[model samples]
Target: MVDTTTTTASPGSRLLGLTTLVGLAGLILFAFVLTEPDVRLHPTTGEEFGQFDAVRLLYLHVPMAVLTYAAFLTCAVASAGYLLKRRPWWDVTAHASAEVGTVFCGLVLVTGSIWGRPVWNTWWEWGDVRLMTTLVLFLLFTGYLALRRTPAEPQRQARRAAIVALVAVLDIPLINRSVEWWENRTLHQQSTLAELKIEDLTLFTLMLGLVVFGLVFAWLMLHRFRVGWLEHAQAGHEVALAIAERHAEMETLDVDAAIGRTGGAR
Candidate 1:
């Protein structure tokens, strides 16, 4: 078979790489130098919550959380598209986005835990509806990834994965609204971004973080989608080779049987 894959980088890839690099540099500059150092106050107690340096983690945590949701949303949409169109590219896209989204979701949990430890005086709280729902969301997608890994026919696997992805997305709204729905039971604060009370520099830094992470997600999705395509092509090649080997084996057996019959007749 001819190796049809291209080795040359496309213009779009170069542009994406450049944009990601510039966004990352801006994120670092804004995170370290441009942002103001001011302590956050407790939402309820009106007392000093923590040092500004520790609170700076919000720049990383919030953006990661947002990106996690975005990635999963992409996965869900791709999954739906695959089911409707029955296209291999849609399955590839759904798989790639799920893998990237899973990583970002894990980061969201880790960073949120680190931020919560000092502020809430707990590493985790089972009773916190937001935390619990977020954990559930992570686990559901983790299961979706696991389902994709199990051996099956291509269409079967894609169908199963799509169903799981769609089901998993149902948790997203629940997770997002957990803090609001169970306001009395959770320590997690309501959306402050909507209120716009955050300082100018801090808000700017957070927005920069979002842009950087969003670019990173896009770059990873592109690479991962390519990888999925390569894997699918390789699997097809292996199946063809297996079929050819089986055909050759059958031909050899037929030749042997014919020779034996002719010798017996002689």
Candidate 2:
């Protein structure tokens, strides 16, 4: 028997471990130090917006949304690459990124809703273009993932999934620009990073959050890609084993027929 198991970590896994540690430390600093309570005036009302503590959620919420977009963009690029290059690795990468993107997109929606409850006095606004478009974006990617799971030949499944990924990405721009495209219809505020008035500490914390989430996204994608590779490898191995077993069985049947024919001749 082969010694298939080993206690060694790959370079990629080591890098991901280090990143996870650093990201956790940064998030801790973000929670304890950088996110100290502070007040800001409402952009439109010219009145006090007392969400000093609640606004801390913005650090996570904004970064999660950015990471979600990053993952989907990665998926789209990988899908395009697979279509051009016909490499299995590209298809695997696209599938992994889409899965990660879906999870992060869900996080964005959850955090946004939590923030909205107190700030907007509503958990959701059906008519809000940004919110509604983001929901649609999430659903589209979910459908992309489901399409990947449909039973088909490996190449056919990959081709179908790549197409879905490409189509799903069309919604990304719409979700991103929905606020600007329908400015009056959205309750969501335009990006505060565009304004010069945001406090330095808040911006710093948000940047930290982005860094942490980016690292986390990288870590997840790496692991997911490896798992996909392993699954592909195992599938090929199974097919090889099945072919070999069938060949052995045919040889046995051939020998049995030869023995019976020899006996008849005698």
Candidate 3:
């Protein structure tokens, strides 16, 4: 029989979908503003009152990093739920969030590497605290994915992965404080927009846009989890059908043997 239960969305899932769409729209608007080359630097002074290129990474990178942290937080919450309540949905959420978080973390590392290459003259640096800790965070989540693939019962798998997820959350604060941990001369200059200028206000708005985008990312995770559950349910249905067909075949063989014996005896 088909498992219909797994195919449905959670209560109020539509709200999540709506929130994601709104966030995506905001991200697109911010992206357009960030991409315009019209925002340029002074020809002589070489200083840009409105230069947008170097800061463009802010439009994508900061939000992604923030989202990565958010995803892990979601995983931690879901894992906690699984541990305390043992609900299968919580396990699914934990796995889903972890997978999504890992993807964003990868993006953060790549984008940061690109930004560093232009500003720092090196694509990779061991001394950069933010870069190093970010890489470590990526690997830690990658490890969580590997942990998920390991063999064990369902609850056992969830529990083990939950512990890993919690441990990994510690890395978030570490990554945030990495700049303080190591002294680096090549570090990207801090955001100039923090001075409360008009452009800075726009950057603040852009940051809000990024937050919206992050929510969309979270929505995507929940959707992906739903798809996983649907596939699992379909597989279970196929197994059930196979078992039923095999039983029917055995019954047919038994009936045939009985008829032959009766006919021969008669």
Estimate candidate 1's alpha-carbon lDDT, on a 0 to 1 scale: 0.87
lDDT by residue for model 3 (1-266), tens: 45567444665677887877877766666665634533667899998664336556667777888888888999999988988998878888899999999998998888888877755667898766677778888899899999988877667888999999988889898776655555462274443445654455456656776767667785678687887677556756787899999999887787877889999999
Residue 148 error, candidate 1, Å: 1.4
Q: Is candidate 2 or candidate 3 better by lDDT?
A: 2
Off by over 4 Å in 2: 1-11, 41-48, 250-256, 259-266
Winner on lDDT (1 vs 2): 1
lDDT of each: 0.87, 0.86, 0.76
| TM-scores, one per candidate | 0.86, 0.87, 0.72
**Worst 10 contiguous positions by lDDT, candidate 3:** 185-194
Give stretches of model 1 more than 4 Å off.
4-11, 40-51, 243-266
All candidates in order of lDDT, best leading: 1, 2, 3
RMSD, candidate 1, Å: 3.4
Write one digit per residue (lDDT tens) for candidate 1, span 147-178.
98899899999999999999999999988998
What does the lDDT read for residue 164 in candidate 3? 93
Displacement of residue 207 (Cα, Å) in model 3 is 2.6
- Candidate 1 TM-score versus the reference: 0.86
Which pairs in model 3 have colliding backbones? none
